[model samples]
Target: MGGNATVAVEATTNRPSSASIVQTLGGGSGIDTSALVQSLVDAQFESRNAALAKREETLTAQISAAATHKSNITGFSTALSTLSRSGNLATQPTSSNSGIVNVTRLSGAVLTDVNARVEVRQLAAAQTASTAPVTDKAAPVGQGTLTLTFGTASVADGAMSAFMPGAGASVDIIIDASNSSLQGIAAAINARNAGVTASILTDSAGSRLVIKGGSGEARAFTLEATETPGEEGLSALNIGIGASGTTIGSAAADAIVAIDGVAIKRDSNTIADLVPGVKLDLVSAQIGVPVNIGKTLPTNALLQAVSDFVDTYNEVFAALNKDLDPVTGSLKQDIAAKALKRQLQQLTLAPLASGAGGAPTTLSQIGVRTNRDGSITLDSTALSRALVNSPDAVEKMFAAPSGAATTGNGLAAALGAIAAEAANTTRGLGASEISYTKAKSDIATDKTDALAKADALRTRMTRQFASMDAKVAAYKSTQTFIENQVKAWNSQD
Candidate 1:
């Protein structure tokens, strides 16, 4: 190729093409322009960019660790709460004959270990009486004011005796020519809601108007009619004391139950007032057979609750004590985590208020021991003995002050407060999390800004290199022309 081989270059607005100029200048310019510019930019900013990247990664990891620690703390708090309930150690009522009678503990019921003879003589029934079968049940039984009075009534006498004044009220029902059927009468009676409900009893005997009063003796009502004079009166539908309508059902009867040989009569089968906290649900009439109702010892369940609490406590402790590493742990150097750890450890040793049973003063007295690894260990045998001997004391120690589900005053309460403080989103360790979150945001922003600066630097370097290459190419072109002219002159001489 000739010494000055002409090369056509593309047009440029900002600067000439650096690659084109570099090829034209070659070794004459004595500069590897691209490599030099990249080296300078890297020398100036790469370390700073790398440091920012590292810091961002660290902050992200810290945030993750903080979240995990917070979750563990919350779980521990919940476990503590479950451990401190009165129901955990409270006596549960069990009947020897559940098939005959189902027993349940009522709220706020403090059960004592006492045997009671419960004989359910009869189940309280609702007063239900049906009118004799009619040709069409839908036929109207006439509309009128069905005066309902509650008290003892007899189907034999055709009268409502022992009248209860306040319990008695009259309901006005409209039974027009459109509705004079037994079904219509039942609908009218049901629509009134006057201490009674009615329905059509359909059988081979045809449809009968069956009226059922509210349960118990007080719920018994006698239906007497005083219809609109022009309208058909409800006198023919009377089931009161065998006047004319056949009595298909009897009057409401009280439940008769004998407790400890004392006869108790209640309007409903569910007897709550008879026993202080005990409720007797009469399933069936077992007259002579006595079903014993009392509380059995609740030691095993309480022991299991304690064991679960210990397991949860250990989990929290282990996490807090874990070595601070990106892969394994996040809260090793965290102040809030360490503080919580100390507080929780101290709670196990702290003196707590004795519960109603008053067995042991401290948890250690119940055989929950602190291990050398900072985890808790439960001596099952000792715990069982303590529970068996003084369960109330153990319960009170772990129980909240009010002995209710809400939080206050106990080993569990103290631990719960500590956990809350550490995990609370507003003030405690939550502030630490917030700080880490802000740090992450700032680091991300800084990295973005740094990258933008790097990009700007690269653009500036590229523009400057292009300009330098163009200048060098122009010089090389002029030098080639001059040298060629001189060589031509020499050859001519």
Candidate 2:
């Protein structure tokens, strides 16, 4: 029977539709919509946070770089200061001529009776023949044992030999068999700190060994066994009698010289140590029963100074360029860096090309040159030649007095000026530069503050998103209840 369907009971009016609930809660899709929104927001925040973190890292790197740059600048400044204040530069000897001059040349008279003199003598000794005996005819000839006696003390073992005082003259003998190897024997004798040399010599006459003491000392020789006899007995070998000791003598002159009225002693014959900037060499010494000294001017020192300056300048310039060049991705990327590079380049090349007064300025004049890399290279050789040819002219170029109309500056003075400018707080952006220091501080502060702000914002955003998630969850439950009631009513109908 087709009975009329019973009318279904409607759910309570208090129940709201899913759409209505969602609309009241600001129109979000039903599936954990708050969580999704929060996730997106959190992702955006993280992205920003990551960007800020990178920026802070970059800032930190920059600060470190700035500190390093400042240190380098300070080091350069200190080096420059030292160079400027280093009184007069030391002189170098000329290569072509003898590197000394006679004291009499300056006095216009023969300076005789020099106090320092070295004594030399020659030693003579008789030659002796020695031989080593082998047991088997087939056995190769080998070195035999040698016994040396000094006063009562005697040494027996392998032989350590060397020539006597005079070369191609007499031979000295040393007994060096102390339970040590040949090398050890040599080491022990050398360690004695006695000025002597030991060596072994072999010839068609067989092997001959010798020892020689230093000049002014006598060396003695004695031999116990000449050759390796099959018998171990010392008396069986019948080594020959040794010669009496003799003395070898040679002398090196004292290195003291008088310069500008100051008497100074040095290790080398060159007079650079006596005069702050003068290097003199001994040209000729005529033996007049009392030697007569000859004098020569120092010309190499000035040339070398200019050359050294140029080389040093170029090295510094290359370093500066590397630091400031943008293509290399160097840490330095500031106006000051650029300016320093420019200044170095200018300074390095200026001496080579610029002229003072009416004279033409050639690096050959001052002792520097422009290298292939557009940098300055010191032509020490050319400069030296110029100085030898015209020392006074070279000196004038570097240290000449100024005229009434124009004030002249020397190389030392110019370097000092550059150093002063570098040290000036307002000039280059070096360690003393206010702007550089301020930038360092300001960037550091900005990075710190930005990081702190980002951290705080992230924490607050986290809490807000959590609260929104709870509210969205409650709204979802209410919508589920309403939809379930509508389903039940339709089923009953």
Best of the candidates, lDDT? 1
lDDT of each: 0.69, 0.42
| Tens digit of per-residue lDDT, candidate 2, span 370-453 | 656647766566676666665544554444222322113444444444554455566544453465446657656766765676
Model 2 off-target regions past 4 Å? Answer: 1-300, 326-333, 348-364, 371-373, 393-407, 431-437, 452-464, 483-493
TM-score for candidate 2, please give it.
Answer: 0.43
Model 2: lowest-lDDT 10 consecutive positions? 104-113
TM-score of each: 0.81, 0.43
lDDT of 1 by residue, 259-358 (tens): 8899878888787776665677889988798888877766777777788878888877776677343356666566776677677777666767544555
TM-score computed on alpha carbons, candidate 1: 0.81
The candidate scoring highest on TM-score is: 1
lDDT of 2: 0.42
